[model samples]
Target: MLEMLDNPQLVKIHFETHDDLVLVWANGAPPLVAEFVQVKGAEADKLWSVADLCLRKKQAVGSSIFEKSLDRDQHEETACFRIVTLRPVVSALTPLTYKRGNEARAIDCDEMVALKADLDGRMPNVVSKRGNGTGYWLDNCQWDARHDEVAVKTHNRMRLFEIMQAAGSLLLLEHIDILLDELRKLVKTAGDAKWKPDKAKKILTRKAFLTMWDACLAKLKDDAAQPSGGKLIEKMSNASLTGTVVAMAVDMRLDYARSVRTSRYMQPDEASQLQGRVKSEVQNLSAKRAAGTLDLDGPAFHALCVDRMDAINASLPADQGDRSAFLKGCMYDIADRCLLRFDRTGL
Candidate 1:
């Protein structure tokens, strides 16, 4: 749940059990969000229903808020609440029924509507025997904590893309959109169902989108490093580095990234995950160039790659690990991967 809220825009955040989670609006602009919220399961089963549990808590909290309001000296802050459940509310045709005190009634209408009514005090207060206060309720809500990790992650991935866009990383956002659009189409096409919302989430969630963005930033740092900041670095244009140089630079980096990914230290599954992360950058690089956004000339590209290498070399000790030095060596090797070195004679 917190992971979903780890957005750049969220100015304040907190978490708790029973309370579950708490968030306050930041900048008062973004309309909050649908945080994915993975639900856990058990043979013993869940402790509460979306409507029942929250309906009760809302009354209790509302009563408290009401009591506090009477004091006038005390102030109460409004909070939103959400209840996520593994099971979907069955259809009214199924005649879902529940006990409200000694009476049981058919859930003859939309369950959520019924729930909202209970929460808002529009219906008979079934929260507790006390039924005091106007009844507590949320400003907004959802029942997202689901058993499906893919669905959960997929929901979060889209939110993460929103975060990226808000952060002004347009190139990364467009790339993720392209990939997700294709993946969603492929999933629905393969399922052969008319179309369900859940199918799309699974296919796109498995790949780490943020990790792809991190790789892009690393390349940007590489781009910024071009000419190693000798005044040239301050104004180096990606246009300074041509397309051919970038393709070659990506090739060398991928090989290094792959070797690290598949190293014996990594478990088979872990290695695959690492490879997946690097490969995403390769794809994004291709997309960006195809879009004509990045096309630095030879000198600029060389400087970018070299600066990234220099940063690594400066940070670590010269002999910390043979493996570390070797990685740095790979960076240097690509310093001229696409450019031919010529003597002053110009041969």
Candidate 2:
């Protein structure tokens, strides 16, 4: 979660006993307000449409404002009330294809409308009156509320990461790993002494360690951009992100190769075999073209590829049950790769 909201200037208080996620922004910027957020879906199996959850007395955003331990006298009041949900709200007015990315699914429009209606009635702050001898009116009750959907939680971490970057947080890679290891011991030794709000505030407010963090970030950035940094970049680039992209490329094999540039998943041994197969077939096509046995024209080459792929699929084992779809799809992927290679290298 720290990595998700990776802003150095933004410190979150995790009290180990509160439902409220408090965000304190101490960038010394004027008018910057603190945010109090409620994240739902911690106990739910699935998310549904409608605002039933929003008005819940214990867990909803509206109630959180009152339930939170923010002492108004201590200047801990927040200006933003937010709820983050894991699932999409599906409603009647929702488009059939609500989400564009394959990773993120769409929500129902009817569900969204219900939630919006429920929140609209409660939001923008409403004050009630009691006809007692003393007269008191509510002021400074305005707040901004938002309901957010974070698509596949694991898959779309980059969105949160980009937010961290935009907030001037550096992605320190290995250097951070080392610093964090040292920090773990530092924190452990410091014990609860530094855990107090005032003591902790001293850490960020004084900017005592800011120079050290800055130096490390600058050094890491400089090292990563130098000629020697090619190895670091390669190591970092070939992480699980490369495998994820490779899996996607394999899924979209029948399509163009635009998504295959980062292809890095298949085992080296298996890749060698596929490489051999591709080269052998390319060589055979080149020989046929040279001997005038095969036409090299665009349409002829395309037709020839289709015929060759069909022949290849015909050799699939007879036991391959329901042979129509998988066999055909496999053939298309190989054929598409071949065509893509030829287009790229003309070999």
Candidate 1 lDDT score at position 293: 84
TM-score, model 1 to reference? 0.33
* Cα-based TM-score, every candidate: 0.33, 0.32
What is the per-residue lDDT of model 2 for residues 150-258, given as tens digits with 9 covering 90 to 100?
Answer: 3343223444334434554433222334445544453344333434554553232214344545575466454433324233223223322244533433443322121
For residue 190, give model 1's deviation from the true position in Å.
Answer: 40
Please report how far candidate 1 places residue 84 from its true position, in Å. 2.3
Candidate 1 residue-wise lDDT, 66-145, digit = tens: 23222221113333334445555433211122322212232234553465465445334424222322223221223344
* TM-score leader: 1
lDDT, residue 235, candidate 2: 28
Model 2 misplacement above 4 A: 1-20, 25-30, 48-52, 55-78, 90-117, 120-212, 215-347
